[model samples]
Target chain A: MSNEQRPVWHKRVTEAISADELAEREALWVPLTEEVRELVSTAILSEVDEHAVALARQHIRAAQEILGTKVDTGSFGMHVNDEGLAWNWGNAATGQKNAVAPPLCQVPIADGVRYEADFGAGYEGPPGCLHGGWIALILDHASGRAAHLEGNGPTFTGTLTIRYLQPTRLGPAVAHAWVETRTANKFVVRCTLSTEDGVTAESEGVFVLARWARKPQED
Target chain B: MSNEQRPVWHKRVTEAISADELAEREALWVPLTEEVRELVSTAILSEVDEHAVALARQHIRAAQEILGTKVDTGSFGMHVNDEGLAWNWGNAATGQKNAVAPPLCQVPIADGVRYEADFGAGYEGPPGCLHGGWIALILDHASGRAAHLEGNGPTFTGTLTIRYLQPTRLGPAVAHAWVETRTANKFVVRCTLSTEDGVTAESEGVFVLARWARKPQED
Candidate 1:
């Protein structure tokens, strides 16, 4: 669909999020997302007693009903369209409190975005290694963020290439991304994943600026 | 660590899982996992009332305590060593009931492995598109599975390259992988992601047989 004809949600990009709002939203949601991640991890790893399971189920059901009554039974709208919210907060790679997130925190650097994370048992692939897919997720997020910093409007990933140099141990790790090159509507970003030991993975991604949302001058 | 000296858990592999056992385990866990995923998705999207939040917290605490008292607290052991259970069940990409999972079901074709899945709201990225990271995750899993089917004992992803041909919509999609080439200890696998429309993404991965766990003859 043409950008002009697209839904309001599609037009709602990071440009709509202010720095102050991003910080505030991150502050409010980060802790909650972390708690949820903890809950998910514990729930999966913990061997629950029958009584506890029953109690938990009851509580969840009650919460669902109460929330259902009080809140509109509507789709959790597109992340971008959510007013004053950081889309990354609900993301699976870097969302702070999202249950599905590895719960990485993104820190801005001079060149691009950097992330610090600990891939817990919940994201294991090999015996004691982090899942390769999760590695890609982190790189993809970081690279996209880097591309965004290039001062272009929202962009979509066109291609991503990842090299797993070694097994990423399941624990604290670091990732960094920076814009490598930029053309008319494409940004090539490079990212790396490392640990105290050394680099574990590296990635390069091509992010294409949405054709419909392209800058007027570029057109 | 050398294979012989490595921990027992490291030695555990899918080959050890019998077909009957895998089936029984899948039957037992798939539904439960799906329930958990639903709970996770709902928890994130639902807006809670103050009273409901308090009640939910209390119930969660009680359940945690009860489960804590009745169950031994320890890290969930390595998946491969978890008897006949499929580790993929709780995985974020291909897991059946994981909220983060696209829940791609892998089916064996003559040459390699194929997967069919639907990218739900939980995995959305660019407006109506599937997250680029998710596409990478699916490709990684499929390629690795292809490497495994090549009669190799076990493999680790050495590198993965993905090209997105078009936006993968948030609905039913398909993926396939096959061993493109094999060397002494490495298998090059190629994979593709597609919808009814056409190919959306393609990937090439270099899977290296784990150093410590090479087949005797190959070694």
Candidate 2:
């Protein structure tokens, strides 16, 4: 597995933008992403009539046309700069440009990566609980992030095992992940998801650094 | 274990809407949800100028306002009827009204549950691959759906173990799940996610029938 020759299928665009330009672009898009997420939550809870739904559709269509006027083909692969700055805004877990992503805010934790998100109507599962699949997503993302920080390269999920101890309620929830063990190129990470009801889900995962992304100066 | 008294936390609402009304509602909301998903993908790959971006925001805001004028209080829990019709269009895995859900289309199969989805920019993780978390989601959902049909109750995922054999490329992916073993109230399900590249990920899961959802006539 250490020398697994997986093809590099990811998009890595080399951009000439400066740090300031990247920040400016993020500023421009973050609000739009947030608003669209809000729109999703609202749409889920909305009990509007036919007329209102029609009007909403009209406005949404207009927005689509405007945005679609000039678009890039395929997915939003990672955009990296020569100065070593990299951003993948379309990431499914924590992408700033992904409205479907969970509204997770990463906290500066002393031990591992801590993420806090209010599981709303949009994240419902059994009744008033966060979907079990989202639990897996959060753990995978947090664990990969933790591994990425330590590995200093892209870490892909190799295997994941999760236990749903309790139904994660739809409200403020927290996730904490840290690398439990690691070799030269692989990491074992553990994570937990908790709400006011305490730890609802936990996971253990294997992550490995992509062979192509490895640097010659090994640890 | 069969008599495990886990708290019934799932929302089971009895609505008075007719079957015809339910179909009508789905027709109305499914389009809105679909368009929003398209918007999300568009926003991720859009490289539009400042003016178009600004204009898109305004239209999106207007849609939000119109939808927000009348809203419900909380999550769209399962809406059931006296005639045994149930609809949870806000479900995370395949809710018709949920724009955040992967665009999965369930196909009728003789043995188990089957689902197909075209993973786009909105579901990217590694470069051009589907996020690992979403793979877990699809497997969990398809397996639970399979168990639900045979068990005749809402089945919750108790434990899940997934082995990602290869990178699941973003595009047409198929999932097939079936109950491999079963007890009085618990089902051991197996599922696999496949793309044109072959089976990329597979899973084994424990699904338990919700005690509250069990009918008096047991198998």
Candidate 3:
């Protein structure tokens, strides 16, 4: 359809979801994802030479405070098309520091529940090895997003499983996710990370309602 | 025991575990954990200024590469007497940064297996939040560690699950981790990241093989 011919609510649909709405929506936060990509890119490009790395880190900290800091994966954005297509480009495993954002990639296999991406630079840890926490972050986001895609009610991780099969070296890395099971609002998602050699890590998570966080709103 | 009265092996134990030994002991790099504690403390104290953070990170990366790294229970060294009694004082999470040698830290309990730690100006990310990758580093380690404590076989994480619950603000945030299940060599570990109000992100992981790396002559 021509841009002008689109439905009026199309504007609302495309319009950025409010932060609250983003949080309330199950695994959907595309607007915030764009903002984060920009934020991280700016932080990366503005580093001072004397302490480029430190400067980049400071920027990350500031972003976390506003965005809400945690151990691994943090708040990212998502998108759901009218065609039921969903894209999650934020909450990247790496590349949150560069001018070019890491691709929020997806795969058609696994019933559109699997995905992967590669991010780099200021995010490095243990020399060439990817930071352990970063691995967890990506797995969490991928699996959680997978669970959300499984048509389950809002779910939060109640349990998690991880296995570091090998030392994940830096540079290009691959990730994959898939839904394993669903009962009621709970969805089980499984995923893995791999290097050129083979699988480096694998994970699974159980997403459930925060129940208390899901209280009915006042009229 | 007095220094002179201590056993020769005890003195060797007190001495830092060599990088070679660390690599050879893949089943449980307990020696490497000790070294990491020292290394983290050294890196933190070597320079408190923002410029020195990179240097600290470099040292940590170097040690991790040579000696390998291990997940934690927020505590590092446990002084065990011949009687099986243990007193853990080398915990990175609770120890002083300057005295701790390596910068290893125990992520305070945020909820379950979720946790948060600020690299601070000493450890910067894009601008404010912890480096996204660093977040993963901690989470992966924690997930694997939780799995180890929960099951049999020298547990290594076969998989990890995480969700960027929020941006993971840089300041004082919290992380949580817990075990979901244990079946044979497979153990499931879960984690979460949160700011002051409540849980912002969550993670889940599975650890398997128990001593996958531990073979008679592999190392």
Model 2 steric clash pairs: A10-B127, A127-B11
Q: What digit string (tens of lDDT, one per residue) describes model 2 on residues B60-167?
A: 999999999987656788879998898877878788888888767899999898999877888888877888888988888888888999798789999999899999
State the displacement of the C-alpha of residue B71, model 2, in Å, after optimal TM-score superposition: 0.7
Q: What are the runs in model 2 whose C-alpha is more than 4 Å off?
A: A1-8, A215-219, B1-9, B215-219
Compose the digit string of candidate 1's lDDT tens values, residues A1-219.
Answer: 233322223323344666676566556544544544555555545455445555655654554454345432212334453354445333445444346767667876787889988666466566556768888988998898788768456778888999988877666788999998888888999999997669989998899887776878986
DockQ values, each candidate: 0.35, 0.50, 0.07
Residue B96 C-alpha lDDT in model 3: 27
Query: In candidate 3 chain B, where is summed lDDT lowest over 10 consecutive residues?
Result: B5-14
DockQ of 1: 0.35
Interface RMSD of 1: 4.7
Worst 10-residue lDDT window for candidate 1 chain B reads B3-12
- Give the C-alpha miss distance for residue B49 in model 2, angstroms: 2.1
Clashing residue pairs, backbone N/CA/C < 3 A, model 1: A33-A97, A33-A98, A34-A97
**What is the Cα-based lDDT of residue B35 in candidate 3?**
33
Worst 10 residues of 3 chain A by lDDT: A4-13
**lDDT of each prediction vs. the true structure?**
0.66, 0.85, 0.43
